[model samples]
Target: MTEKNVLIKSWADPITGACPVAEILRTLGGKHGPRILHCLTEGELHFLELTRAIDGISRKVLTDQLKEFEEQGLILRSPKNDARQRVGYSLTAKGDALCGVFGQLYDWSQYYR
Candidate 1:
């Protein structure tokens, strides 16, 4: 085996076993995920508002992304009414913290952009 491969495996084995960074990236690295979180950072939004705010995202894609974000505890989904079944999405504490990181990243990128 190459020395680099051996070094990488040695460094990665223990750390990669419980890597939250990998999981976070997996959740937020998607095309819609960052945008979804960014919108939610503003305030709670209904399904239609989300689709409208994020141009070019289809309903199906938004639905899938919302479901995944909810499952990951990055966002909250609650029915707006008992009878109407309208749902609103908001960022959780964890989601807010992640978005703070996104804000920092955005500010940093402004230097180059």
Candidate 2:
């Protein structure tokens, strides 16, 4: 099969252990997931920064979303390596790939607002 065919087959057959889009969609379908993912578009952010940017989100919800994103291999959460108990979150390569779609959606929202 061609490379493109292989890629499509991989994404289409979740049982083959290659497809992850379904899981990603499920996790990101939650209210906080899209918000958190959107924030990562600009740059890396710490937990506090994310919480502040997406107002009305509770600490528990943010924590859950971060954990889900990490588990989905969409975002990376790493320590600051400083004295402060700081951890930073950034989009992984897979996560970055979704930026185009997210950006389009963001732009489209302007029309509705």
Compared to the true structure, candidate 1 yields what TM-score? 0.80
TM-scores for the candidates = 0.80, 0.74
lDDT (C-alpha) at residue 53 in model 2: 98
lDDT of 2: 0.85
Per-residue lDDT tens digits for candidate 1, residues 33-89, read 999999999899999899999999999999999999999999999888758688999
> Tens-digit lDDT track for model 2 on 1-113?
78788765446654677556786677778877887888998889998999899989999989988988898788999999888889999999988888777888778999788
Q: Model 1 off-target regions past 4 Å?
A: 1-16
Full-model lDDT for every candidate: 0.89, 0.85
What is every candidate's alpha-carbon RMSD to the true fold? 4.1, 5.6
Query: What's the distance in Å from true for residue 103, model 1?
Result: 0.5
